[model samples]
Target: METMTTSHSLRSTSINPANLIELELLSQIVTQKQSANDIRGSIPYLAKMAQIIDNQRLETTVAASSPQQQQLQQQQHTLRLLQADAHRQLGQAYMKIGQYIQAEASLTITIQRLESLLKDDNAATSHSIIVNQLIEGYDLLKECFELLGKPHMVQGMENRKRKYTTPAPAPTQATASKDKSSP
Candidate 1:
């Protein structure tokens, strides 16, 4: 297992180039020789050790991703849940610093991902075999977004509601005429 070239770095922390290189080399040695944990002390280690963790994680993901779409789906489901939690935490952090717009954006991403997951019966419903819990999660996500208090999100929600509640407006005559002229 190895990291894919197209893998996006996580937002939790940026991997320092030096640390990434060192850790990746160490990772190779560790994997090849299956040595003891004492091998970790050889280099200038990253304080948070983000690169090492990401290296292992990226390897695992790549290996699993090579298998099938079912594997990909499961991975995506887990990632979405994790992303929601990360966004919530990030939003809270941003709010504490008075960065309300950043907070709102992060929370909105959280809420939107959760909502999308719920709507995807495959992701949410597939989690358990006995029953469909997707709708329950859907409602919870709706509440979460409302709690976040973003004006645009609320407006978007309202617009979506109206779209479903009211039928689509009849097409304009000019558009109808143009359509009729098409072969």
Candidate 2:
């Protein structure tokens, strides 16, 4: 389709066109189709977006510490998040279309990507967002396993989902009393 070139003030700097308006439009279309309950219709768009984002490359001439470089890094992070989301959406669409095999594959990819992003201490995206996405991926995968008649896989996926959703244990009463005395 149509491609738009990004204008960069730096002498040698550019982000892949696929990572810009085109991807955004595709994402919006996918969102619309999903909201309209046309999950099958959204599948192609989500898949296309995922493919495009995965192939994108960010080019920049600025120093690593420069603001321009920081901006580019942020864009890269955002693109990664979008890529994970696209897969997640694709999985959901496949599930709605009764394609459990495809759903499992896509959700697995989504979960791996989110988990990798979560491990990055410098990820610009919020931890909660990544965690929530991971939880959603696990939930979808669990459903996929159930549909595929894989009860063992379902229990494992449920445990993984709980890992993200369960709150950390509260401080012990002894620890709390010790802190009170110290202060």
Pairs of colliding residues, candidate 2: none
Q: C-alpha displacement of 35 in model 2, angstroms? A: 7.0
Question: Estimated TM-score per prediction?
Answer: 0.37, 0.74
The residue-by-residue lDDT of candidate 1 on 23-121, one tens digit each, is 567546544432443323321232123223334332134444445556656555665665565455455445545556655665666656666665664
Model 1, C-alpha of 28: deviation from truth (Å): 25
Query: What are the per-residue Cα lDDT tens digits for candidate 2 across 98-179?
Result: 9999999988888887888788637455888788778878888998999999999999999988888889899999999999
State the lDDT at 111 in candidate 1: 58
Task: Give the C-alpha lDDT of model 2.
Answer: 0.81
Best by lDDT: 2
In order, candidate lDDTs are: 0.49, 0.81
